[model samples]
Target: MVAVIAGPDEMVGRSLPFSELSDCPYVVLLGEPGSGKSTVFETAAKAASRSVTIARALRVSGGQHVESPLFVDALDEDRSEGSKKDKIFQLRDKMLSSSLECWRISCRVEDWRGAADLSALQAATTGAPIVVTQLQNLSVREQAKILTSRGALDPEGFIGQARRHGAASFLECPSSDKMGVLT
Candidate 1:
């Protein structure tokens, strides 16, 4: 997956492989609804030698016993009626009280409240810089690769048809629903 550090100039920033972000102590991954944020979060959790859910991590007391990052996905999936700011502040308090050293949180770009949310989370950290990154749409080559891997009988033909139908953008971010239509 490709990503870039999110900021005012992010559109022109250089992109990097998502794997390179593991070294960051705090990361807030923002992506469109079907941009694979949850997939990436799950992949990281599986790849990490040691990892825990943020909820479980928060339950651990006595400070930083867990030596790995805590992974939190679907930050925007909360069904609570509370305001976003309230949720962020509650998460901040939990992180501070638990004294967790590392975290990776994923949320839909539309749901993210920008710097305010980042600032709240940053306050819980031990001065480690918080790096916010946004997931990028899949390049055409990447989309083709996925199609090939999935045993598409005619990946190029499908791509052409999608383009003709003005649905090519869906190819860049294939969610389950979108994939159903494409495949």
Candidate 2:
């Protein structure tokens, strides 16, 4: 049976049925260089502007717990692009594994060399709102593999695998949101 499509007002911008965004503790940002991943983060932050405290994990038992607002900007400038990727991934894993109470995350990957592997990890992981973007070109199949392999969203078969992933993924453009837009 075919169901009727609803309007945004009816659904309130919800595009997925099994959505768990309300309770999501984290948001994973993924994309290739110049894909506007940063822009999206800024836009989403602006959309849900609020200062919520978040806890950071510690290695030692009974260790000091760090707290900060829900906003997390893990982008790095001094380090090499590859190092930056590692930093984000490490932070992501830590946040996911710990009992931290974080609401939003903002990450950017300007390097595509390690994008596929990282994206796959993000998609497969549960309990978070993940956004992956890329400015580089890879076959649609490659993109699909990364998303599905990580368990983000699934397409029916091989054909479905040849598409994009995330709540939204797009090419970079001048219209992209600025960091201040979120502030």
Candidate 3:
């Protein structure tokens, strides 16, 4: 179906519509910076009816006024430096709480603390079968470069491993995915 979405100037420019999300239990969007997380909500909101309520994470922290399903931009600049871990746990708790019908969160994989937070979020969400999407960066080459620089990846070794496994490599690639911190 062809979906209609309102532009940025509209009231629903960056929030999802209630009808579009009523069936979804909860979702967590995972990716790096500038990965179009806001766009997803914006598109969903365009088709929604007017008067749907939405709020960001900062406002939620100050006073728990926003109702579910809440759309939280976890990568927003307003997040405090020292309170990231706490914020994540709070979000997790809120998302999983009985009061919330649904919730959505976005975070960058490159954020070291967020990386840890994702694991905890993943663990909690798994029981509820939440949808998770990894939005690939616009520049795949740059994405590879970031991984290499982080020492989380070794390009040469990856390519060599890929060659060894032939077409089946990705089926078992990024070996790190299977390795623990101590491994």
lDDT top scorer: 1
Kindly report the root-mean-square deviation of model 3 from the true structure over all alpha carbons: 14.7
lDDT-sorted candidate list, best first = 1, 3, 2
Ranking by TM-score: 1, 3, 2
What is the overall TM-score of model 2 with all chains considered together? 0.35
**What is candidate 2's lDDT per residue for 1-183, written digit by digit as tens?**
001122123433343311234344444433445544444445555656644222122212233343422444434321244433344455445544544565344334543224443464363245443432222333344445444554645523433432244312321121222321111
lDDT of 3 by residue, 1-183 (tens): 111122123322234322343465555555545445555555444443212223234335544544555666654443455555455555555555535555666555454253465566654443454544454322334334434666745655654554576732232222222232112
Report lDDT (Cα) of residue 47, candidate 3: 42
TM-score of each candidate? 0.76, 0.35, 0.45
Model 3 stretches with alpha carbons more than 4 Å out: 1-23, 48-63, 76-85, 94-98, 112-119, 122-127, 137-183
The worst-scoring run of ten residues by lDDT in candidate 1 lies at: 54-63
lDDT of each: 0.69, 0.37, 0.45
Comparing 1 with 3 on TM-score, the higher-scoring candidate is 1
